[model samples]
Target chain A: MKTITNKKNILYSKKELGQIQLLLPVILVVTVFSLAPLLRGIYLGFTDYRLGDPISFNGIENYKQLFSDEYFWNSFKIGMVWTFVVTAIQVSLGLGLALLLNSKVRFTSFYTILILIPWATPPIIRGILWRQMYEPNTGAVNILLTNLGLISAPINWLSSFEFVIPAVIVAGVWGEISKAAIFLLAGLQTIPNDLYEASKIDGAGLWDQFRHITIPVLKPVLAAIISLTFMWNFNTFGIIWVLTQGGPGGLTRLPMLAAYEEGFKYGYIGYAAAIGNVMVIILSLMLFMYIRVQLRERTES
Target chain B: MKRNIYIVLILLVGTILFFLLTRKNNNHQNIPLRFVSLAWQEGTIATNKSIVNEWNAAHPDIQVEYIQGTWNSAHDYLITAFETGDVPDIFHYESSVIIDYAMRGYLTDLSPYISSEMKNDILDVAWATVTRPNGEVDGIPFLIESLVVLYNKSLFKKEGIIPPTIEYPWTWDDLQSAARKMTKDTNGDGVIDQYGAGLGLRNSANIIMNTSISFGGSFFKKEGNHFVVKVNDEEKKLLQTIVDMLYKDKSVSPASIGETGAGMIPGLFSGRYAMLVGIGSWGRQQLVENAPKEFQWGVMPPIKAKTQTYGASTQTLSIPKKSKRAKEAMMFIDFMLSSKNTARLALNDWMIPARISCLSMPEFKDKIGGWDITCSAVSTLSIGSWLGAPGYVEWKSRVANPVLQELFAGRMSIDDAARRIEHESNIVLSRYKKRGEVW
Candidate 1:
């Protein structure tokens, strides 16, 4: 009796074919809606395309101009600072809330539902709410601060160079914290009670157990959330646009805002696309590093 | 259950496809046109809707629908719409943007479509706004605003100051000193409760470019062929004046410096600003609802600096080149800008009509709500030098405006601003030279 010694299957089996057919609609949608535009945007980055004008190949001229552009560099630096600050604040605070909610407490379910309210709000709505609340004369923030004797004069939070980035970061974090919190909460739930119980019997303190058990187990979830938050915060446009329009001397001009202004406002379509392309490359590099690190860590463990 | 869901989804898809097919089959004959309007005022929106309704009722063959738009993102919206060829057939935009669109060749040169009577009706200066360098009329100029300094009459009276008139205009220095004198520290607080002047200097380029002629600053110059951004001394004067109001005089509120014309209303009503430097329409139209009962505000007559002139960036109507119904759209524009309709539209908008005949209407001559002041200042409406220059928008947003904002915010020195303005503006203007537009 001879066994069929095939190392690989030459054809998609009947079930595999069915699975692919089931995914056909999704593949079609992604190709048409997302992939097409993405490819078009990338192609446009290499051309000198102005609004309603004939497009011509210009090689890497747009990228060259971007390299020399002081405003572009400034916006890039601002975007980095914004992304870092927002992601850091959101993750730490979100983890803290998750931990508190996971603890045996009163109305934990009710509090979890209440925390999700901000996640449902649109970014532009949050921006408008924050802008109104930051109004110098009648804004709730200014009124409350003044009543509490925090400062003598009202601070123009959205306009001042010193405060604008921080203010927007606060607003950005407010609308996004629940997303991180929920993910971390789910990861926490998946953690085994036996591990904590064993740690307690071993006379391990809260910090020791968290550092050894929670850190090791929640590493993958943390990696995913951190990467996602970083990407989202970097590409943010709506809240900053509505709140500042990259104004007060462009102290808050993120790369996305700069791209928007260049493309829509100034009609420099190719240049804007070039900016977008550069952002994508930077983000992809960061993502690639994230995956590599994750793989290495998994191998080590 | 899953199979049932899939069948239901198929039915939904079929229904949608059926509806789309039916819509395409039956509506091929009467393709309706869309008119996007940036009329946000309650009265203006109502008037715009009724005008469209009246046209739709009259023209059974060529139907036009009104699409309400906001001024906040009008330029951004139009740029995308024009790019995607999804624009409304007739769009209400400013001549500044129309000039930009025309420079890009996005607009239909309505020269042949414009009627002779309509051509003769609109003033030459107003017509010149949307006219290209080659004399192609890209749009119909319909409404122009009169620049006025609206003052609190009660505050002026309390200060015992005489209101300046068009005949006896205030000198630049007089206006400055008056503003300084009016700034008061009431309620024994160290902080000034009432600012002397609060100017809506936001859209710094718009304010500076439009009013720079009044300060003898043309800002833009045509050198040989391409337009050059000139910021030596004349342009610096206007920006310095704004900066001085905020810093040197300390009479203008820092917050108000970044507000729009309409945004200055709350401060004006609350007496945070005793005087507001803005356009005429803000006082005439926007105040109808925001004003306190019997709130007496008077237009502080014109100010004379180097020349008592300001640029008139008229709100205009233009047809997109890609619009299939260009001829019908032109008809709608003509209907919208007729003598009677223009007058009604201008009255409702609280702006001066671009049509020459509409200026003589009895309503425009009314002394109430500063209509007399508004109508008289029409003579100072100079054709903006920045209108035809595509490079100007880029230069303004990138170089001139940010510097002016920083200067007004008291974050940058005047010398530093001047250096940056010239150095950066020259770079921008030189970059646009490659576009071959000015040439």
Candidate 2:
């Protein structure tokens, strides 16, 4: 009996050891490729390292310069506005679409799949398609509008600074709304039918039930989606770059575009890295706040 | 347990297979010469590929590979590669970036390699554009381009305006009158459907400088070899006058101010504009490929400014200093620039051959549909006249572009714009001074 027990214990230990060995490769890969590069980038941000030159310590000069740079500040303001507007619209539309699809409506599955097309397509392709659509003349949108007698002439959608950002946001939201909708739709599936039935039994109206049960239940998922979307929108460079190239007097210049222009076009790598580092800090604080709110709500519930 | 043993065996086999494949790839002895280029048009790529193939065939010891990237991304890609010490053997670069790269010790000077005869074969302007002030030939001269005034012949005939004589080109006043006459509201619409002229706001400084020179205004007075801008007096007035015509006269389209979809070159090709200011290389192709047969177009000689006309620098090929195959690369470049191949490549690509002998060749002239017209447009460069300036790259980025943007927005007067440019340009120059650098 003792020998048999010892053998069982040894077998269990061997299995556990084997499982840890299997996980080591994945852990090493993530550390090397993702975490190490990110940490190294942060370290490089503090140095005055031009391309093809040896790096040297610069202390707080880069940061100090960034603080006073008008272009940087303007891009930061634009980034914040972009994040807030895109996040609010994306979340509201996504939740609404998810709720609509969650109901016992006809063709719900087909419609859900159809909405995923934009999300499934590449961001560059989406940007290019939207650019063609928004072309001032000989574009589908202008042609349709003119035929409908909506306007007398074509609108310069991208040329005007006032319209360029919104035009980019329209394309950005097309992708983001689908992603958020899918996430919320999955969250909706987890809600028990009994909960809604109980609410109805208590004589609560549909709006009241949604306000009470659905939103509260979706709070955690919604917070996560919004935080992720905000980060993505803050780093949104491709759509704007493809459409405007931060042109027409730099009105549409986002933080990422500014960083790219400085680093690549202007050959100011150290300054660009500083800009990137500040962006990371801002995004990290935002994420931390979001996670704190979510955790706090969870504990209270 | 038996299934686990089979899985282990499969994993072992896979590892061995991967090792063998990698080893096989590593065992290849011929070092591949990688060439990165921004010239990715079908004809350009085909020509490059043929050259690479020919070189490889002759030199079996080395194999060559070519990577094509877009113009917008090529500079960034090359910079990144240089930083990483992975630069290709040879690359195509714009004239603006040559000094910047050469100053950083990224380019290999070719002065020591080429024969004097071969150097003399290249045009003097082409040679000057590629050579640094210190007499260092940092890049090999290949093709040369000059800016030309392209006007629609049909429009000129319809308006009964004689084209400018090549010997005595039109002045700014003549250009203004021509443009005013050309602009029309065809179909009796309140809006003007046809524009008189189109200038690329994208490179407004080049156009501005060209126009300014015609007004007898020099950007700088050369003292010995050093160039300094005459920013305060006549040049300022010339700049104001040009801007007034562009914005106040309303002869050009509002598209210059970002109102319409009509971009400069494409607008000209589509018959939306009567005249266009574009580079000779691009203009040559535009005439051949897109211009309608019945719509005749003629090239106007470079507009004169007090005995000279405005001309910009052109493209050159350079090898990276870090390249292991510099000898072979130089040989290939020399072959490409030979009169025979140069003419062949230039004709196919619609680029002006840098070789003076090839310029008069019938094969070179007849490549594009409108040969004499295009030749006459750039003939001013044969004489010694150009829009040369120091800190061209910095001036373009920091001063000229922003001020032009303001002008396009109609937010600043031409005088105010010139003053603002002078202020900002001084700031940029001061920074360069602090660095103790001229470029």
Q: Which candidate gets the maximum DockQ versus the true structure?
A: 1
Please report the candidate that would top TM-score against the real structure: 1
In candidate 1, stretches whose alpha carbon ends up further than 4 angstroms from where it belongs are A1-10, B1-29
lDDT of 2 by residue, B330-428 (tens): 777786667877776777667767787887888655523545545554445532122234455656755676577767667777678767776666655
Q: Relative to the unseen true structure, what is the C-alpha lDDT of residue B390 in candidate 1, on a scale of 0 to 100? A: 59
Alpha-carbon runs more than 4 Å astray in model 2: A1-16, A290-301, B1-29, B57-63, B203-206, B209-246, B258-263, B305-308, B363-370, B376-399, B419-434
lDDT of 1 at A25: 57
Docking quality tier of model 2: acceptable
- Residue lDDT tens for model 2, A10-49: 8787778667656665675678689998887777778886
lDDT of 1 by residue, B1-87 (tens): 446546755875787689878856433548788899998878889999999899989999988888888888888888888887767
Q: Interface RMSD for each candidate model?
A: 2.9, 4.4
Candidate 1 lDDT score at position B87: 73
Q: Rate residue A258 of model 2 by lDDT.
A: 89
Query: What TM-score, computed on C-alpha atoms, does each candidate reach?
Result: 0.94, 0.88
